[model samples]
Target: MFVDSRRREGAAAFRHIFHVQMDGATSDRESPLMKYNYVALILGVLLILLVVLGNILVCVSVLTERSLQTATNYFIISMSAADLLLALLVLPLFAYSEFLGGKWTLGMTLCDALMTMDVMLCTASIFNLCAISVDRCIAVLVPLKYNQNQFSSRQLGLIAATWVLSLGVASPVIFGMNQVADRDLSTCKLEDDRFVVYSSVCSFFVPCPIMLLLYFWMFWGLRRRRSRTPLKDPCHRRSFCSTLVLALCHAKSLTDSVSDGEARTQRREGQRNRPKTVMRSRKASRVSRRERKAMKVLPVVVGAFLACWTPFFVVHVTKVFCGWCTVSPTLISVVTWLGYVNSAVNPVIYTAFNTAFRNVFHKILSRWM
Candidate 1:
């Protein structure tokens, strides 16, 4: 849905797009904009396919793979469901409208429904990420109570709350708030300025910081615990083994009536081999910083979400208050599609580091291949 020049209500044609021409207003097939639309249409179709495939893999992997059946992965499955629904329920019409130059050919009913689902699902995605962060924080700060990856009532409650709160945020659209007297019939977008602002705050502003802080606390706790109790030294164990081997060699020499000279040679060999054992022990005990990097899916996921969505809410809220400011239609469509890209991007980036999901994904995909 898009907003018109009058700044009145718009519906599901990505509603915040302001100053778009009416339907069939631009029919120049050979024009640059038409060529651009063609490219966008192709890309949009690929994006939909990717989102569907990737999210389906996530859901199936979590359901079918025993290793992925954990509290954290359940949250991921919920998040993937949101992205998958966005692709199935929302993006086709969104891309069609973009091709139509922001004209909402779909009836007002579908437009309203699409707009509601769009807000709810996008917000639900953010909420699920926040929930995952919260779950990780709990596992870090209170390990014994977390039950080592059990899906408890608390996790269920969090997932339920995520959807319910998202619905609450978007319920106003369902209540005919977009049916204003001066609404544009040609374009569909969000109708109420207050709703745009409210949804923006609820979806992005509130949850993003919570995710960031929770991840920060989790890392801090992990580092602090590791610092309090350093890892055991390996040199002591290696030295004991060396002495036992040397004593055994000497005892065998005595049993064979071997001379002290030959026993001293074996003892000297043990002393010479001690440095290699110490080096091997040290290498085995060394910790890599990549271990910390491997656990950084939190930052990557949250950062991608924010990178994709921040522009959208920022533009929407800015358009609400700064009516005099001139934002290009191209910019609006770019940001809107950027949000759509997030649905595809999240499933890929979020599960990229998860070995269980990757293994299951390979197993499922291998059957088709």
Candidate 2:
């Protein structure tokens, strides 16, 4: 009987040990999840800060520097403002939701507001980029007529229209047209397929194609210019030969004392002005080189925009169209954050491409330092 009792005790002990082991395993799984949550929280905060600061710097630099206050840079300023709005109004809420494991504690009205702002600001940003591409294309293709004054008013009108259109795209939510009424209150998303399609087309599909076409035309113009450059070399050589012959004739006249007194004075004056003319030509060439470099950097901006936003938009469209396809929440979060990262990247691209922005940024930084 005692042996049987001892055996029962051992069995109970084994069961207790098994329970303890299972608990430990569960805790082990949870620890990594908790660690991940902490990491995500930290990263999200940093991203918000980065986006805010970078865009603010861009706006301030443009506003303060007269050189950057041109018509082309007004589009850039608008882009920065859109990004700043996104970082301020959208990102904090997103970060909070992310930290809470995608559960939005914010109310439904705020949820709708957040989603509206998200769609509106992002759409505006993309449209601003499209405007920039169009502006650059015109500047390259029609240099003589690309006056900033002629475009300034039109650009302002276009920027205003861009926001109006963005608001129109996002207006359905405010009117209760496309809402996920029965969706989980813990999560806020545009669940209506029609609204998704509309928003996607307005924000990405239409604008992306237009941007691509403008860039293609711009590059085609550039290639034509480059190919014709060699042809211009022969004309330049002929002009040089003509100028040399004229100079030789003038020298012969001077040597033969066939030139009048007034002519000798005129020749001396021309010799004195030649160095100044060469200096002006060299300065103009340098300016042209800088403009070309800026032009080259623009494609990089467009390419970066495409790369950063494509995956998010692709997954978004797929989710809307494929009802049965399941996507992990983590994946959605990653792609959403990826899109936000573009806001941070933009000012960096501006600083890299445009020397004026870089100089203004340095001046701003120096004041603080």
Candidate 3:
């Protein structure tokens, strides 16, 4: 009995010591892990803040400002809504995962919903841009028909279609397609490889080419039209000059008659100003030159979009199709967030390129100040 008691006491002390060492090790491990992810946590929070604030500015500017209430701005508003929804619904969860060092502690159902909203909203953003490109193309080519200032039924239909199509693309995940048997619930991503291909093709591959082609056609038509008619930004000023000349001509007939030399000089001056007269007449008929200015800014927007998202889709597809090729989770996370960075970028692009948006942003921001 005495020997047995001694043995039991020794074993209990050893077990206690072992557990204490383990506790110490775990604390040490957790501290470094926490420190390692602190950068991600800080950056993610800033990104979320930027996206939320910037997109909100866009929404408010378009909604409140009458000048911004054009058809193209309506498309911009729709796109802003998508980005805003993405920042609100999707960025937080994904960012929290990054804070946890990319561990998805949020279970399957929430994760699937995240995936759904993420895919749908991002796709909608791209589609709206595509719609913008198409609208601009039509406006440039067939300027008379496209009401640059008003949203027609066709414009509303196009915006609605983008959202609906995005929903269609993302609906599969919501329908339990992400709930595959024997899959790890801790990992939150699309389950089916085929679905990856489908989403990539629909979201990036399909729209990108179409958008590029439309952009080409738009610029082509614009260049040809510009070459033929030569629309100038100083057209309004030209119209005023033309009006001034007409007024002088009308007023001159009542004045004392000029010498033959002076008469010839006046005739030459009127001939030089004749083109200005034509410009004055065409003032009401010229294409919306604001659309041309918009086209100049669009290449920057499209280039940024492509730069951010191209790597993501390329890596996304390669990981699926080339199973032998190894991609790190870190690389995947980097590219994914890089794509999310686009939501924050667009408002900056608009503010930089557009005077109307810039003025409104300044006005709105001044009130807050």
Candidate 4:
């Protein structure tokens, strides 16, 4: 009986040691894991703040500046508004999901709602950019037809159509067409191939090609106009040539006689003093310095959008088509956040390229100072 009691006590001590060891191991595992979570949380917070603040500044700058109230800028304002909605409604939820290790705790209904808003806002932003390219093309190619009275209605119609089309693409999920099943509760994704194709075409494929084509057309038109117009500095060269020709005439007349020299000098002086009429081409005058800067800056905006969003869409479409293919969660998260970075970039592009926007932004900042 004594031996059995001793054995029981030894067993209790072993179990106690095992528990202590496990506790230490668990803590060792959690320390780095907790650090990672903290880092991710901080990054998410900063990203949200950046997107929200940048887009808000853009919207405010547009609203406060009367010079920026053109039809094209109205589309820009709409794009900023859409991005602002994305930052507010979609990004916070995404950040929370990231914090929770990709587990969406926001339930099924809110999940659907969030996903719908995500697709709608992103698609609308793309359409607005495409519209901006088209509007700029019109303004460059046909300034007379791009007057405010004519273009305002067209721009308004385009903006309305953009939102309507975005809604149409995103509404299928809301109506239970493409939904997350209970078994796949861990994932919040659009599993329907049809929905994926439709949304991809509407959001990326169609608009991207249109934007590219319009920009190419704009560049071509600008290039052609530039080539046709003579360089502006030719006036100086022409003046030098005229002076040389007059000197040659005076030298020739000097050899002839004093009478001939005096006559030629008088004629040349009269020709030089006569009013010089300079005629500038309509196309050269039409594209102002500001418009040229915009033309140069817009391609950078489109390129940035393509760079940030293309990987995400490519992987997304691949996942939709190839069910057997495995994409790491980390890759997905990185690509998605890259796409979100585009929202933060838009306002930076505007402020950098646009003088009026920069001035307004500076004024707005000065108020705080």
Candidate 5:
């Protein structure tokens, strides 16, 4: 009886251990969080690929194309470089952070460093755009004063200053102001919501509003001196040019018809010798009309800048006020990716308004291929 009882006890213990192992396996196999993380990983990788390719193309085209090597082009190159840095440094880590499904695995120090880079590089790009706007505004307002030679050194100095100031502002956040993984939950980021808010405010809020005000003033000044100013809306400039070309063609046809009629009448009166002189005089008048139709596209670009960046500002404001408004991880990812996508669109915007850039791009591409 004792032996039988011991055998039953051993068999029951073995059965319990087998059941526990099955349960552990089931838990490991069916985790929803793991599935979601896999999705985030795939999506993040795709977006990073797009950003890398697009920014690299912009940089390469600017460097290779002679027409794009101007001071303005250099600023554009700076902007593109910043964007590429963000994609390389910030986006991949962000994706990995998400892969942990909001759980940070890379500890705190690295996280703080990445957060600092994101803030600093992003600020540098914003200030760069603002500088471009100011330079373009100045160029349009005082064409003779903005000699490319004189403007180049000043622009270079300002670009350097932009980098120095960005680093200065961002250093505190990375150095010790921010919590490290060694101290807190082993994750790096702008842990203080208040600090994030302040940083964004100082970087985007203050500078962006000032930029808008300056742009508005520039537009007003342009309008006030309308008679002396050439066309500045790059988009409008193209439309105006096309219209002028058609109008000139129509006028030339009309003048030719009138001249032919006059010559016919003169021939009937035995004086058919003045058509060449009359046609030459009309051609000179047409040439003068064409020369008066040059247009500048800086204002159009200002409008585009406002449109592209306004949504981000609005989203930031909504987040500030509605602190409890839970945004989906997916939506956050989309908005953040869209913000990065801005770098991709800028070259296209320049091509749309600036004929010289377009022609240069075409020549470089053709030659390379």
Candidate 6:
């Protein structure tokens, strides 16, 4: 029975491959399509360039910025490293294939290696993202107990684990007995439909859902904790610990006081008498409380991951799970490059959202500029 089942599975895979080859040949022979190829080539090149420069900024900012170079930031560095590898290893093939109207000139070994890297890096990025989210949930929920020194070692262990797991799922492409098959257009790819489906599920589908769940849970936990514990800072006289919220609230009260247009004098007096202690204390304690607040920076890192990776994950799910899927060669090329765009986006997200990262990034740019 097992042998029969295997035989049936093999036959189905062969059919899938046969269809793919036929589709490639039909697409190739039907038209010149040079204009479409040119557009695709331009877009792919842009994505590659963006990914390279953006990731570099992120790495430089994290390393050079003393404030951001924490244990949690170490995980960020690992994530960035994975993104860099993705761009380096995967984007060129995607660009070339799309530019030549889905033609593949690279040999069989390269095809296998490229696919492996594509799957491995993307999986690793998502895995690291989930890890970052979990780390933040712990840090935010238990700020007092979350020490960087203690967490750093564990974060490194998690980063290592992500790579191992990613490589494990991607192993079949590199080492499985199934050999790369040539398409009608001479492009080589994994010919085993079962393995392809399995890898896609393992790499994209399974990991993404889990990451989404974790992110939702983390946000809910954060909201709950935030509501339960009123912001308390002995040094600040404001009702809220959030400085921006307090500022906005203070501004609104002033606006209300002035709405009469007759209380202009009173409004000026009120502003004069408004306590300066909160502002002074906020500034004064900022430097002193750096260490105290640094442990809570995990949220910033996780936020970066969420922003950079979410679109790619969403688009991928649409491609893999949708019914009657028939992606154009150009569209596939675009989405593949878009995935690489996530790699470049991670560093940009970090630098843009994190204050410490921004400062560090500015400093690095200044040195070069």
The lDDT of each candidate is 0.78, 0.79, 0.85, 0.79, 0.66, 0.66
In Å, residue 181's CA in model 6 sits off its true spot by 6.3
State the weakest 10-residue window (summed lDDT) of model 2: 232-241
Q: lDDT per residue, candidate 5, 24-134, as tens digits?
A: 888788774555588768977886776676667668877877656666667778777887888899888988877777667786778778879988887887888788767
Worst 10 residues of 1 by lDDT: 282-291
Model 2's TM-score against the true structure: 0.76
What local lDDT does model 5 show for residue 270? 31
TM-scores, in order shown?
0.74, 0.76, 0.82, 0.78, 0.69, 0.66
Native-vs-model 4 lDDT?
Answer: 0.79
lDDT of 1 by residue, 77-189 (tens): 89999998999989888888877767787799989998999999999999998988887777766665565347989999999999999999888898898888889988889
**Prediction-by-prediction clash tally:** 13, 0, 0, 0, 4, 0
Candidate 5 has its poorest 10 consecutive residues by lDDT at 286-295
Kindly give the stretch of ten consecutive residues in candidate 4 with the minimal lDDT sum.
274-283
Off by over 4 Å in 5: 1-17, 29-33, 36-39, 148-150, 180-187, 228-330, 351-353, 366-369
- Residue-level lDDT of model 6, residues 87-137, one tens digit each, is 778888877876777777777678878878887887887788767766655
Candidates 3 and 6 compared by TM-score, better number: 3
Comparing 1 with 3 on TM-score, the higher-scoring candidate is: 3
Evaluate candidate 5 by giving its C-alpha RMSD to the native, one decimal.
10.6
lDDT of 3 by residue, 1-369 (tens): 999999999999999999999999999988856645777778888998999999899999999999888888899889989988998899888888877777788788899999999999999989999999988887877776675345898889999999999999999999988878878776788888888999999999999999999999998887776667645544444566565566567545634677666766666666567656665445434664766878878888899999999999999999998979999999999999899999999999998988888999999999989
TM-score winner among the candidates? 3
